[model samples]
Target: MFRNGYKMKPIIATLAGLMLIVALACAGESATPTSKPTNTPAPVATATSAPAATVPAGATATEVPVPAEGPELTSMETYMQSSGYMPEWGEPKTGGIFKWRVSRNNSNFSPNMSGTTHGLFNMPRYGSLIRFDPWVGFTSIIPDLAKSWAWNDDMTTLTFQLYEGVKFQNIPEVPESYNGGKVRGDEFTCEDVGPSAERHVRPPKWETTLKKGQRSLWHLTGVTCPDGPLGYTAEVHFEVPLGKTMSALAQGLMVMLDKDWLEWYNTEHPAGMTKGTNEAYHLGMGTGPYIPGEFKSDIVGEHRRNPDYHRDGLPLADGIDVVILKDFTTAFTALATGQIHVMGRGSWSMTPAQVAQAQRDFPDRITVHPNAHLFGYGVGFNVGRAPYDNPKVRQAVQLAMDRDEWLLLRDAGELPGGMKMLALVSGTPWSYSVEELEQMRGIRDKLTPGGQEDVAEANALLDEVFGEGNRELEISCMAAGVEYVEDCLLFADMMKKNLGIKVVMESVEPAVGTDRSKTGAYEMNSGAVAASTDFGDPDDYLLPKISTRYNANSSAVLRNLEALKVNEPELMLWLEDTIDKQSRELDFVKRHAMVRELENKIYYDLALYIPFGQRMAFPGTGPAVKGYRLFDLSLYSNWSIWERVWLDE
Candidate 1:
């Protein structure tokens, strides 16, 4: 049986360093790994130094044969071993604030209601059952709230043995009901499990409550917490292989909310010093390293260390203060002047030039982590819309998208991280090798002769599809944030110049961007997705991203898929089935093969999203900012890292 349990575990702003830009040498590295919590737990991750693991940043993979039987790898030993990604940020110190920056702020603090940007700014306040290790090889796992877990003989029923005496934060100032008169609620017990498992982010039936749970499709049938909210153990039952259940639990999307907190939130009673702040934050709490402090919807949000936290020796810093810098240039200035201790530790907070500048100008004042990060970002097409609905049209647009040009235009084609392949594989064990990508059409080096041939083919496809007169049509494009708006402009220019499509670009608020994307309200939009953000499961990202199901395809987030389904029924069914098969396959090697038939590749064939402006997080950190790294590409999970970081100053 394939049953196992294991634990583990941007932004450019400046153009200050000309010489450093030319020679982006390795900063430094160590292998100490993340600090372990005596109380809290770990997450779902990649296999070990085991062969198929580690798809080098800009290199190809070395294939290994799969074993026919025996036991598959579990997460138990994944965290101890380092993938040589650790940074020697000095000994851990205590008591200082981690001042970080974001392009925007989050409003709705609810799990299912929030967007990616929300995680970027406030994820540290949330804790999951399992969390991505804050140290190296984020693709692997460790424990978080879950003390340990196990699957049955067929790998269907999963159970979690909870850590005892884990108490929820007690901010008497924030509650929605007339219960618990201004005191810490109760210990996180078994009763919290039933409501969490019964209601989640995934879709079909449960989706009605949480419409966008990591984008559609699930295998969980029921969850039975026998002892209710008072006990510790929780039993969950699934209809198929334990897929969505694992990712959802580990990703923090489905958290074990305090039973009383849920009651107050559901009943709608109010408490707290400030009504708005309480509603957005304290109303729902968790067993995390930090507590939500003073919050300004757009300007800033403060996270205070949880003194009564369940985890011991955690939250090395006293707190985290996340502020917003409208654009990359402004954010870089903040980092340079030490206005913020770290920028973009969670999201693409800065630019490549700024990273080089920070290290060059403030060599001792700042610490630049030159390694770790693979961003899958670009422009997503709404396939449910006409013209975009046509596969040939989609393919043509993708063919014309010059990934190399995007790099040049966006980051001057020079990144300290080097030229990295994004999207499709996203630096995962199951990702296509650089060698294989070189042979593909939409990907591959755009400066080469083969690339020119691909462009010629794209023009031919466009000619065949649009004829001549209607070639120049108009389309609306949108994106959120200053960086994304810039990305939108570059993509719009490329599409107009190459595909003869006139584009209108708009930079909307972050919330608007998500709602529009979720509803397919635009023709194209700036996009990025961390396939491993939720969990290292293909089902976590793929199904909702590319599925033909109405409102399921997040890349398109189209309203009606009836047109695409009618036109390509076989392809749609196969894509859906393949996604399902991969989710069910527990063996690493076999599942890798199924993830990509690799012949046509879904990203290229479906052409719903064309990845351009690829990025490797170039986060700039002040000297005092130590023990910090992106929890995941999209900054959606691993908020637990806050527990490991300490402000050296």
Candidate 2:
């Protein structure tokens, strides 16, 4: 059973070091493992006696098989243990806060509505029923709020055994605590889980402002907490026999909401504030290891350690202080100046050129995690608008794009190595392969090295659409991030050079970028988005992204699809039935075939989006930063492991 979850953009910037571009190559069923290795020899520190093994940047250490004389390896657990990855660290001593910098200002901590920034901020506070194990390249599942879970024979129903004593945050200062009856925190129960599950599908009208809530709740029919052998047992019934039910419930979509608190909040607050309410942002409680302490819009969001955490020896740090910056250069400067302890993956945090510069400047402090991210940059067209509404023009733009050139310019003329992705979601069985992608139009003969420009094809398409040489395009992008700004400029130049289009690149503030995207205010927009394959399934990518009604990005072609579904009932029915069957299909081989078929239709046949290279998350930390690692390459799930991190200095 596998399912990929709806993915948003990778952290908007690279926080500390150089952004190393690592190519993804499939090995069996698992996604490529992301490794962060230092460039120089192991630093001599008195913290431990043994020196840590250093795998070169952009390389995975081959797992050597046990000798014939030794016992055969059984599972990944044994392999990882023997591979020296499970090194014993000295006893953890917790005290200091880990200062981290995020590129974008977090709007709010609302689970369903928030983007990457808000998601990361909420991670230390929230808990899910099931979670992707980061140590295993997210190939395995681990318990979170739910202690144990199982699916019935037909896979239509999932039963969860919750941890009986877990409690929500008890921050008395928050307004939601004034819900009269209890001045203290409430116990996390199936009552909370059932209402949260129901709320996932039946979001309030205000939820329309939240980008990805109801759209992700597909297949889930109802959640019940009936009397069972074990108390606090919850059964989640699905409309279809979903193979990736566990994976689907592992992301921000499945965070258990405090139903009582929400009801009280709605009663007290007006609809205006309740739509994107600050009360829900700050007052929301969870069963995790931290509670949100302070929030200064667009500047900082801080969290204090949860004193009444369920886990033993949790939240090694005193607190986490996240500084919100607009761009990566500032973040990089802060990391260098010792203002921040770690700089994570962000849209603008680390550019390829900056990475090269960082290696030259701070070789000892920098480390690169290659092929760790699941999202990438793409050129989105508003199909509802003119000129771009034409498929030929879209194809022309895709064909004219010199990906190889962009790679060179983006990475300072160096190929840092990355695989071409046919679909938005890579690192999974359903992701389109090179040979398969090569067979598609616009991509057939447009590769690197000796590939010629497709100016003729592009011009012909434009000529047919808007006569000869009348092609013009306006692009919308954030002005803060260097990578995004440069990409817009590069694409604009390419459009003019190849298609004879007059390109207009409009740079807006971070908030304005979101507003523009929602309004479909540009002919094209460019940026990288991060998505995760929580269960190695195709539904994650197709459902939230391709469906116009599912995503808040206001995808031009996707929005058109919603209109098409209304106008063309037969096509909608066929699509709905095909996608549902694909989701329920238990056979991996058959499901993969169906996934590839749909991807071909979406990418090649429709050409709604022009997929750029897949994203790579480079997590860089200071010398004294200990136990800081990216377990799951997700916005919310990665920060969940922050509790395990501690500061050495």
Estimated TM-score per prediction?
A: 0.75, 0.74
lDDT by candidate, in order shown: 0.57, 0.56
Q: For all candidates, what are the clash counts?
A: 36, 18
Candidate 2 minimal-lDDT segment of 10 residues: 1-10
Error of 2 at 204 (Å): 3.4
User: What alpha-carbon RMSD in Å does predicted model 1 have with respect to the real structure?
Assistant: 9.7
TM-score: model 2 vs. ground truth: 0.74
Across residues 1-649, which tens digit of lDDT does each residue of candidate 1 receive? 1122231002233323422332222121121212221221111112121122543111111211111221243322222233423446555677877777777766545544434456644456556666555553334445666766676667667777676777777675555334753225467767776565544644224223355453532556666776664566777777766333454555566666665665565556332211235345655576677888877765677788887776555667888777755666566556655667876643455555555454444455455554334356777677677888789887887787777666565441124343335345344455555566667776666578888777778778878887854667677778776767877787778777666777788889988887876777777777564223344445545655555543455443434344556777788778777776766666655666776672245666766667663455556677667666543242445555667777766
